[model samples]
Target: MGVDLRRWWFDRQRLRGDLLWGVAGIVLVLAATLGGTLALTALFPGLAPVGEVGADPSPTVAADAASGLAVNLLLGWFFGFAIAAFQEETLFRGFLQNLLQERYGRLVAIVGQAGVFALAHFGYYPVSAWPLLLVVFLVGIVTGWLVDRRGTLLPAGIAHGFVG
Candidate 1:
């Protein structure tokens, strides 16, 4: 049987409520990410490497970010709201986590999905960026927890979008 889009953790009747919760989730995740990064840096000073090669963006990227603020804004909004929030939550929290929770249980599913989520970023980041990976994994756990608690992907998606 094909998937029922109507039953995919989306409630049209609760759109306003979900949007409010989504905003709150975004703020919460932003604060958590910043605080967590600072805390980790304080605890492990070595994690903050100095004078890394290719750490800075290329001149082209910098120029684009500087001159194309409007374009960047639109693209960022689209990716954050549509791709990261909607698509990722649908895949990770709505489908994968639900299936795992059904087979293995909530705790295992949450952690397992989180690990997978973090690992999925391995190709994008360098291996030396362990602290970033840790933060990503923690965020995944928090997002998964939000989905489990709310029985919806809206807040999780919003939070994930903000994190991205």
Candidate 2:
């Protein structure tokens, strides 16, 4: 399975034109998400209060940041690009969402996956951070829609990486 997966992954025909569109889609979606977040934060500042129980950065995260700029960038690239974008998107969007869509239709699959994606972060965020959950859900929807539009997971993965 691993060998087959690698072969398919590196197949030039399968990957043609994905890089350009994927990067472009990611940039567009990221800009929209950031703009929306800023607007929401401005309108409802209470939703994003700083130094609150769930708002403070974790010690482990702070330590990672303190590990110096190069280390931080490397770690970010590894996790954001390799893990979150490629692996997670392949699993969630490529396999799970695609399977669900075949059985249940597009809307159900998108919303269902988004719900799962939002819930998957429950351990990392407190219930008080509902705003973040909402954003994550919205991002999931955007990524899922991108997958459907592009007829491939590359664009979705790119957008997901940017969101991460």
Candidate 3:
């Protein structure tokens, strides 16, 4: 399996029906969130924080940021992004998504995948990684939804990077 990541992902895709619902889920989340936010802010004008942009002319932070960006790109692209996406979607969004979909509904499956995604990250460092638990889980649901829509994991992975 170590060398068969593409084949494994393709096989998994063949087994699951096209993932259109997954994409819808991602779109719904974004749309719903934006709509609710706008509605609430219109109703209660002073709720949202307005911040002024402060210019940072320091080259040190800029250099560090650029370097960090470079490193992240190298790792995110070259270090088997498809494999990582495949493994994650297979477990959280494939097997478990189906189970949740059958047991409850499509929403449940998306939520279940998100939950698993968060927990997986939390397991990496239970203490310091607590914050990731919430973040990745939210991301999981979005990715799961993407998988449902895209009919494959590759687009989902690419979208994840695009959003990041």
Candidate 4:
């Protein structure tokens, strides 16, 4: 409520910028995730796939992965923009984060938004995966920070959609 509404405006230029930034952010995150997975497997040799030690590249697996990526890319954009990203970002970052920012500042607002975002996931899902909850929380932090930096939800929304 205390934040300036003008800063959140989404004109044509801002939309283009948001799309670029969103893609950039997701690409960086993906690269980091891939690197981390590689490092983890290296550190824990036992964690490698069963019977996959020193195995040659599998064309079938590669094809399957490519197909899956194609499907996921389409679904991600649809769900992210149409449902998940737009709605969740609006509520958590647009409303809650902005409300908290006025009183508690950016750090608290971002964290608080992220905490609530994680809790929402925890409640919606039936799984007992605590690590997933942490991942959701981290996502919230990233998206919230995006909103703060851009003063709009488009970048985070686009990124969220891609991540989905």
Winning model by TM-score: 1
Q: What is candidate 2's TM-score against the reference? A: 0.74
lDDT of 3 by residue, 1-164 (tens): 24343542444544343344434454654554455446655666654222222355455587689988889887875543555655666666666776687799888778877887777776554453244345455667667776665545554554453333
- Kindly indicate the candidate among 2 and 3 with the higher lDDT: 2
lDDT accuracy of residue 121 in candidate 1? 72
Weakest 10 consecutive residues of candidate 4 by summed lDDT: 124-133
The candidate scoring highest on lDDT is 1
lDDT of 4 by residue, 1-164 (tens): 36443455354667888777788768654554455556656665555442444558655677689988889888878987789987887889988998899999999999999999989887643353334455567778878888888778878777777775
Estimate, for each residue in 27-130, the C-alpha lDDT of model 2 and write its tens digit: 76787567767877877777744357644654566555667767867788668878888877777777778779989999998988888887786666566656
Worst 10 residues of 1 by lDDT: 49-58
Quantify all predictions' global Cα lDDT against the true fold: 0.77, 0.71, 0.58, 0.74
Residues 1-164 of candidate 1 have per-residue lDDT tens digits of 57664566668887677677777777777776777788888978877443363568545676567768888777887798777778777887888898899999999889988888888777665666576777777788888888887777877877777667
Clashes of 1: 0
* Colliding pairs, model 1: none
Error of 3 at 135 (Å): 1.1
Where does candidate 1 stray beyond 4 Å? 49-67
Clashes of each: 0, 0, 10, 0
Residue pairs in candidate 4 whose N, alpha carbon or C atoms collide under 3 angstroms: none
Between the candidate structures 2 and 3, which one is better when assessed by TM-score?
Answer: 2
